[model samples]
Target: MSLADSVSVTVKHKSHAADVKPPTKTTARPALTRLERAERFWGWIMVLPLLIGLAVFYFIPFVQNIFYSFTDLDQFMNWSTFDINNYLDLFSDDDFYSAVFNTLFYVVVCVPIGLAISLLLAIGLNQNIRGKALFRTLLFLPAVTMPAAVAMVWQWLFNKDFGLINYLLHFFGVSAVGWLSDPDIVRISVSIIIIWSSLALKIIILLAGLQSIPRSIYEAADIDGISTLRRFFCLTLPMMVPTLFFVSVMSFIEVLQIFDVVFLTFDRSMVESDTMTVTYLFYKNAFYLQQKGYASAITVVLFIFTMLITLVQMAIGKRLKVA
Candidate 1:
């Protein structure tokens, strides 16, 4: 072959060799080191205690309560006898019906009014003022107070005869009336305590929300010569909606299950057609009368009530763009 032919043949051979060589395959990712895997396992192990606690205390009880609602739930058989009669009996009782109504009423009245008061107080406290920290501490103190002790103090304060409330009324030339003993007044008394205790926490939450609002917005509002009320309506209130909704939902749930003040404050004699909350009634059935099955059924109904109300509030919050 000529030199050119030989060179061309060599080039062809080089091309063929290159074409026959396959692309390199990528190796799989390296397995995690044993220590790394162990660390991950340990992290899960650390959380396992909390998960088990929640399952045992909250989830298990919730499910057991539902099961007991469908059974006789007596002490003798350890609630083995499943029956639907307890639930049927619950709906038939007028007292239970009243309790349902009262509990709903309590939730309705307390939620909005309490939230409004708290928001107003939070706004006031948010302003630069003397003794601001002291005021905040005083306001928040009620939230941390023991519920039972608060109830006792309020009982004296609200007493119809020579009570501080009655004395204050006398100063205004009003007559004293039964506060705790009277069915008509019992709800009012309970509502007062609920409102007072809840205000502090809600105020604290709103204060946090207020602090989160961009100060630039307020400065811009000032530059635009906006009125205080207008700025609040346009900017402050809208921004606070998320916080307000959260606080409202929490307060609503708390009110729905209000038992400590109502339980320790009033008795069966004071249980009015209007004053007996579902929780109070539940206590009566479960502990006082030993009707565990019926009480469980009522508890189930209450759970449904809370769930539905929460869902409704969530829907409304979504519409309000609170979430």
Candidate 2:
């Protein structure tokens, strides 16, 4: 009698659970309808503020700059003419040509060297060393520092007389060279500052990329008796290509727009054609000379140049399956 009763109870419980399951599951499921769709759309609506901000602050101004390029507009007023005079003027102006050449030169020199130094630092940091965090922090410090402050410091250091750099040269029995004053040295000095300023941040990015690589790959390489340098080239460098490409693009753009250090270090009279960047030229046109329209034109040209270079880099990056 007791066994039958227990079996009957179990069967009843199972039937009850089976009956309740479908309704419970259905009730727990989220409802889908017009209102729910509207609610779902509100998720995107939440980002509207950010979208609006970007449109207003970035897109509108950029488009306006492109428009203003053709106009002979200035802070005073628009000239009674609309033409491509600004662009034509840029071609005729020797200083403008020099700025263009100087910008290109800076990019060619700084970007590759900066990327190499950053990658090397990243590799060194990836090795298990004492006080690793401290070293990394110290390296990254300059990246976050004010550019003006760095320019001031570099200006003093690059001084021909009573400067640390020249004093160090004295130790090596080399004569003091005019690092900032001489046109030849000006471009080189500026490039050095740029490279030094960028090294820390790029190292951090590449280090992160390196850390993401699995230890199993390295272990396999070692088991095959691959040399350390060979493993780095074959395994590490290939995996880090995407990050390296990104750093290269960023460094290229940064070097192109170089102004603050160039401006602070050199007076207008002292700065030669070789050292004047497009941005510095832009400043002179926009404020000093009050040729805002021409400055706007130059800005558009530089922006287009940057966009083209970045697009080219991205295209090359996509084609690269070397990894």
Candidate 3:
């Protein structure tokens, strides 16, 4: 066709293309659609039974536990018999003081030592090596094992006669220790068990923390010729502080609430004091002595201890943020 005719046709086509409206931008689905709301409603409905169970089994009993601490629940059904004598008596009781001291000592000694050992394990396991999966699984076994079972096994192992530990000690020409019998050594034995049982979880947590650390940071350290100890202190520890903090708090709580291991390991038939953890004492007072009110007081004290630890952690976290 003629040049003007071709040019006119091309211009017409361009005009038509421009006139055609682009597909209207599809509107986004509304937030919380009817279907979404339905799903959420069902979710809450499914959880209703759990909420009810918690209220009935935990919340109500928790309030009553606190109330019982203030009252003489053992002596009378009436609130009129209520007094602060339970608190007064708890303070006066030598057994209570010893139990508190023993429990606090366990927590103080075990948590830091356990964390240090578990961190070393995590570092070793985190290294590029053969059979690491098997190693990880073996390390985590204790975390899944039943506490009572561990307690029983350790009790047997710690036995002065015919025990694996003592047998090993004898082989090395060391005397068999009165691990369970001696009050001085009882806390150490319990601490050992706590460390063994708690090691698995802390190792897993720290391994994850180690893995989460950016590779670039290590590369930079290498480029700067940073020493191993310097790299660890400057890079690893600081970065892993949050995880370490969490692990420390959890370890403290677990050590503080220890019951099964201490109960299983210690010989209750003994004349000498062996196992007198706060929880053990609480059980002895609550059930064996029929002083539920006094036991409740002990429980309240434990609750306070846990809350204080959490609060201190929060304060430290705030300070970290400011820094």
Give the TM-score of each candidate: 0.88, 0.86, 0.84
* Number of the top TM-score candidate: 1
* Stretch of 10 with least lDDT, candidate 2: 21-30
Residue 156 displacement in candidate 2 (angstroms): 1.7
Q: Local error of candidate 3 at 274, Å?
A: 3.6
Q: Please give, for residues 212-259, the per-residue lDDT of candidate 1 as tens digits.
A: 999999999999999999999999998888898899889989998888
Candidate 3 global lDDT: 0.86
Candidate 3 shows a clash count of 0
Please provide, for model 2 over 112-150, each residue's C-alpha lDDT reduced to its tens digit, 9 standing for 90 to 100: 999999898899889999998898999989988898889
Between candidates 1 and 2, the one scoring higher on lDDT is: 2
**What is the C-alpha local distance difference test score of each model?**
0.87, 0.88, 0.86
> Could you say which candidate leads in lDDT?
2
The clash count of every prediction, one per candidate, is 0, 0, 0
lDDT of 3 by residue, 1-323 (tens): 99999999999999999999899998997799899899999999999999999999999999999998997666444454678898899889988888888888889889999999999999999889999999999999998998778878997899988789999999889998988887678778888988898999899899999999999999999999999999989999889888898898888888888888777767675312755788988988877888778889999988998899888987897687676
Comparison by lDDT, 2 against 3, better one: 2
Better of 1 and 3 by TM-score: 1
